[model samples]
Target: MNPKKLKVLSLVLASLLFISCDKPEKPAEKKIELPKPASMLTLVPDDTIFFAGGLEPVPLKEWTQWSITHFNLSKEMFNPQEIQKLREEAKTDGQRLALQIWEDYLATLLALDTQFASWGFAEKPQLASYAIGLAPVLLRINLQDVQRFNTKIAELEEKAKVKAKVETLGTATFRRYALNEQEPLAHLIIGVDGNDAVFMIDVGIESQQTLALALGQSKPEKSLAQGNRLKSLQENYKLLASSLVYLDHQQILTGLTTKDGNRMAKMVQQLASKLKEENKGWLNELHSEGCRKDLQTMGANWPQTVFGYTAFDVKAKPSKVDALMVVESKDKPLLEGLKSLRGFVPYYSKEAVFAPAVFSFGLGLSVENVGPFLMKQWTEITQKQYSCSFLKEMQTDLQAKNPAAVGFATSMASGVRGLSLSLLSLSLEKKEGMATPMPKELEAVVSLSAKDPAALVQTVAAMVPQLATLQIPADGTPVQLPLPMPLPFTPMAAINGSHLTVYAGAKAEQLAKEMGKMSLESSQGFLASSLDYGKYYGLIGDVVASVDKKEGQQQATPQMLSMFEAMKQAKVRVQTKLDFTERGLEMTMDMTSPE
Candidate 1:
């Protein structure tokens, strides 16, 4: 062997060693990107609109009292000397006198407070207050002069009736006059003496035809009728008298017209406008100044106009309300306004007759028991069937925050038994709209020791696969394996509510035969264990299937069969043993075989 040849061989060996020592480089993992979630908004209604004080209507008595106290009535009372003195007074003083007279006259009521009380009037205070409060601006002319003119007109009307044959026309004939004398001074004459006579009566004999035309049946002439004594007398005498009265009354009632009333009305309208403007400005300031700061001082969110009409009623219990209001808004903007308002949560539950789904949502923290609470508060709120997914999600979120904390034993029992036990024992009905069917093959029971029983059950159900995963043991005799244990045992099927029976006659023989075919002792042992596992698994499946199939049939049957007979006997014996003192002892038994 040459030295060069040895060195070459050594180099080849070292190269092989180096190659074995190095590890392969791995590729980098790609990152997975999840889709962005949808934007969500929870809009609530304003609470102030429902509960605020100022939004309510003012009480009648309060309004009346306020009006009376604000106006000094004694100072406003009329004095005949004041009018004469007013002329000599300065312009400002005269104006003050005029205003005072106006106020006093307007405040004067034909009826007294005692009369109002006798009538059993409830809104008397409100009516009187409104009239008095508005009197100063409402009455501007002298009412005394107007009243005097009216009195004189009544006197002349009585005198004319006695002097002439007065026949009235149309509905005006039904109208009565306050004549100074009840009876005529002369002999009464009643007759339709042709067209000229009818025209005379229509003109009220000594009445001003200018004013009488409005009352007359025919078109009135601007000039006096010739040879018609009544028309001529009215033009010369009645016209002048009636005109004076008309002028006086018109001057006093001028304040009642649209022009005069509108001035005061404008002030009120301006006040309302200013209030709204101030509210808007405050809202803008709140937005800019940070809502938290405003909320701290205000205690809650501000009221805003919302959907439909908003009405407020503020009253202490056992007493009449102080104020009441009715606010109306229109269209979808009203709904938007309601949503923009704050301090209230909104919930909507919808049910569809034929659609594939329905939807519902909650806007705030809610209790599991809130469904009944809301319904109790507002009977109009109705229960509705919604999409199962929607309800499940809502329940999930709610339960996470406020889990239904069940005792350990109760939770364990519920979990092991699964929904079946819950359905049977608690009589919980299957909720409508649930798309997922409960896993029939795998039943679990959790011990009551678990924390948050409802959540634990739900968590386990969600985590575990419904299908069973089989694992073979390495050591065992060729005996039947029991079924995989259900978390909660069915007491009726279980042997003393602990162990499960696995093999029947034929299945037992078959399992033993399969175990005999294994070669090595280890293989033989593994085969035996596998047989037991298989047998237990098969038995569990059979028992579950039998229970599922027979439960409904047995429930429907009315016959007193062997199983039922045994149950009845047991019940009697148990009752007799306990002396019938026990309450809520329930037992259910089911038996089934394959067809």
Candidate 2:
């Protein structure tokens, strides 16, 4: 070869050698195979609510885009323009400097996920099953990593400014992250099995028993993984499902009989005991055998077990998302009660309720002729001991206070057939060049349908101090009445035949005057009491457009604006149904998008 050509060939060979020495970039496996031998279930404690999710063949960019679109935000990826905007919004030097700190934190998070996924986290450690289950006291999060994940974890911890301390339990060793002393002590457990599998446990307390359970030194007599009912629930979601969540209500409620059980109960009892010697048995009723049996019965009467599933079809017409919830109950009381909701479905027709609303929520409850049913259920829950004459005869409990008012409210709630609250406006709008934003006006209409309106009027009249009920009529214009709150405000209310209308707002005068215009009839014309998405989307769009016209939209960049425009063209509606079934109830929520 010529001298120049030989030199070039030598340089090329040297470059090739250097490239060979470097670690090759890996293409992440599309399938996520969970850890086995020590599977996610092995880490779960007894009587837990199990949940698991999987995202196979979906890129991070696409997942994030879906999230933004759901929130009605632009789907464009984060860019320097957003960072510049963040800096521009920083009003002080401290805030401006903190931007970089935030960037560092976010960068650290991205780096952690990338490094973990880059090392074949998804498919390297294949398990027979994967899950995330929540017990009464502890939560177990188990997943698999590459064989050499611990060394990488050590280096990352140093860079991330975290301190880790090691603790051993039998054959398993965990790295506990130390937090600030002032903060409540939380244990972060990271343990690896002999197999290339790792699972994490985040517990409020790290007692010897908890560690023993995770290390497989001891086993529970009855665990969620061993329960046939829970296994069936998990299976229900696993068939053509992307995720699964199983909840055993009866087991969870009954599982709180010991130290390793419910944390809330244990804390309450511990504090009560510490406070005084007299508090030794304040919670005796809760811990009693009868009370526990009643609790289990209550769980069976309601929803004993719940199974959930979520699936998506991106290629479907208008793209679709479907969710199903199977609520299993033996007594069928709750499902029957829920079935009574069909009468209230006709309460979302009026668009005026959402006219000036920035955000709003309304629910119409029907309790017509349900006084006996409610009293019976309450009696059953309380074991019908008439602890203190119960509510049937409240003459003893409220005799010191206003006995008549208490008695009336009880009766009124029992007789209430239809009750609805419509929250209208929630934003503070300022006039041009105003010194400060105007006082936020919270407008709402409360409607109640009772068997006897006159009795309620009499009770309400006695409750409000210095309020004259003589202004109200059987069928007349609504009148303003002084509210007994600390604020100087008077709302309007009226009793008309079987219904009562109450209009309340920050501007009492405006609300009082508008009371006659707003009526219960406005909400009673709809076919469904479910959320009114059409009106909600329209209101949201109007609010965004108004801001875009003045201060401009949050998406200032051209790319972001294009994404925002694209988001508007996709119409989405979600309808959730809790239909009563023979065994229990089937609650299904379907969300579909229209292009």
Candidate 3:
């Protein structure tokens, strides 16, 4: 062979040898299947049940542990001796009580199972046969009660015909039956003389023969007991159904009746005609007490259902004072009377009340969690002088859905201090395409005292713009102002005297413009802003304002980058300063780009 051919052939042969010698690739292994997770039952002890004369249920932790132990024992998955020892160590009176109740419940279930088996039924059958004999007895009793109540009501109506002033208040008749003998059953006094009144009107009722029988009434025999139960059920059903109709008619009357005397009378007349067709009577008792007349008079045209009593002392004639104008419900009447009698005195202290409202608004506006972030901003904005109530309420509300209103109120007041800052934070979070970093500053401030100041700042921030926007023009001055651009960043800053110094970068203007554009497009401006900032390795600052185009629409405002852009080809030097305060911690970073 030629020398060149030999060399080329040798190279090819070496390549083939290398390829052949390479380890054969192994086939992919089959994935192992995982077992499904066991079902977990969390037994929460209901406090309400404890108050309602029942033993509290087991605690969730204890129940969980018990279940695990029980499962292990039954399945032979754990040592019985070890499980027993653990149970002994954890024994307590409460635990024992809970176990007893649980065991009783199990026994009841077992007994029910056994009863079905005695009737030639399978254990744990899906459906058990009910006693057919019990059904007819219950039905007859409920029907009888309905007839009896109706007859008694009719008799009362006939007796009251001589003295009762029958007037209709919508579909319900206010039958002012001046009883000859005062009865304790007539606990609700309507007139000035403490005349007992029975609403005598049906609200609505639900009929259950079995339930009625279970409740029990005077029984003549086994059959009589069933008959009485049926009567009671029917009576209840009639009452409930009738009462609902009356309530509905009353609501309708509210719309029809108006301040215009003729219109109000006409509405009442029309409603009376409707009631007469259905054999129902309607009347309202009038007494010279507690602005009840005013409420009735006001409600003549008002579109709401109100019931209660009112009393008012005659200013010059104390002897002729009036005491009762019973409406339909107590709460509405009382509220109205207070308004009328006290010259519209605010129901709650203004300072105390407004805080919760503000807090509610903030809550409705805020994103979940991110407490530390809020706290940091609050400290910086308030200069550690103010604290946050809203944020605290938010944290509390988050943990406990139904936190006390008093705590919420206090939080609201604190939040008011930092209203502007809080709103700015909200705006920043809501802005299109903007991302807000978790506030390290707030966590630091809250850590200082366990009281978060950021909550107040966020509250104040939210309230400032809201109040400003809601402000009526001073003395008829037309409120004309230039529309503000949506602020992607919340205006969080350290207040030094009159100056507000915020963290922002050179590209703030560009970022703001981008955010504004995103806002117009109804996009996530904040998230977009964050992404843009990230591209340039810039940190976002406070949010100023976020405004939706509509009057009541949301607005977005946020702080953009404060640092110079990172050079594409060079390392950047960054310096950061962190300050901790009573409110929260704040971090400031100064970055220099390499030339």
Measured by lDDT, the strongest candidate is: 2
Q: What's model 2's overall lDDT?
A: 0.44
Among all windows of ten consecutive residues in candidate 1, which has the lowest summed lDDT?
A: 572-581
Per-model lDDT: 0.22, 0.44, 0.23
Which pairs of residues clash in candidate 2, taking residues 3 or more apart in a chain or in different chains?
34-127, 368-417
The lDDT ranking, best first, is: 2, 3, 1
In TM-score terms, candidate 2 sits at 0.52
Higher-TM-score candidate of 1 and 2? 2
Model 1: per-residue Cα lDDT over 506-591, one tens digit each: 32223223322322111100000001112233333333333322434532122222223222221100000000001111111111
Ten contiguous residues with the weakest lDDT in model 2: 17-26
**Collision count for each candidate, in order:** 22, 2, 116
> Per-residue lDDT tens digits of candidate 2, residues 449-487?
655656667776687657544456667466775655633
Candidate 3 lDDT over residue span 1-595, tens digit each: 2343233223323322221111111121223221111100011111000000001111112222222222221222223353344334322222222222223223322343332122221111111011111111110011112233334334433432322454433222333322112111111111110111112101111112222222222111233122232233224322111011011222233323332232223334444444545453212222122223333444443322211111111122211111111122333433332222111011111111111111111011112112333443344334422123433444444544333443445444431111111101111234355333223221000000012333433445577774344322212222222235533333322322111222232232222222212111121001100011221232222321222334563333221111122211122222222222221222222222222
Top candidate, metric TM-score: 2
Evaluated at residue 222, the lDDT of candidate 3 is 33
Candidate 3 segments exceeding 4 Å error: 1-260, 276-404, 407-492, 496-595
Q: What is every candidate's alpha-carbon RMSD to the true fold?
A: 41.6, 15.1, 33.7
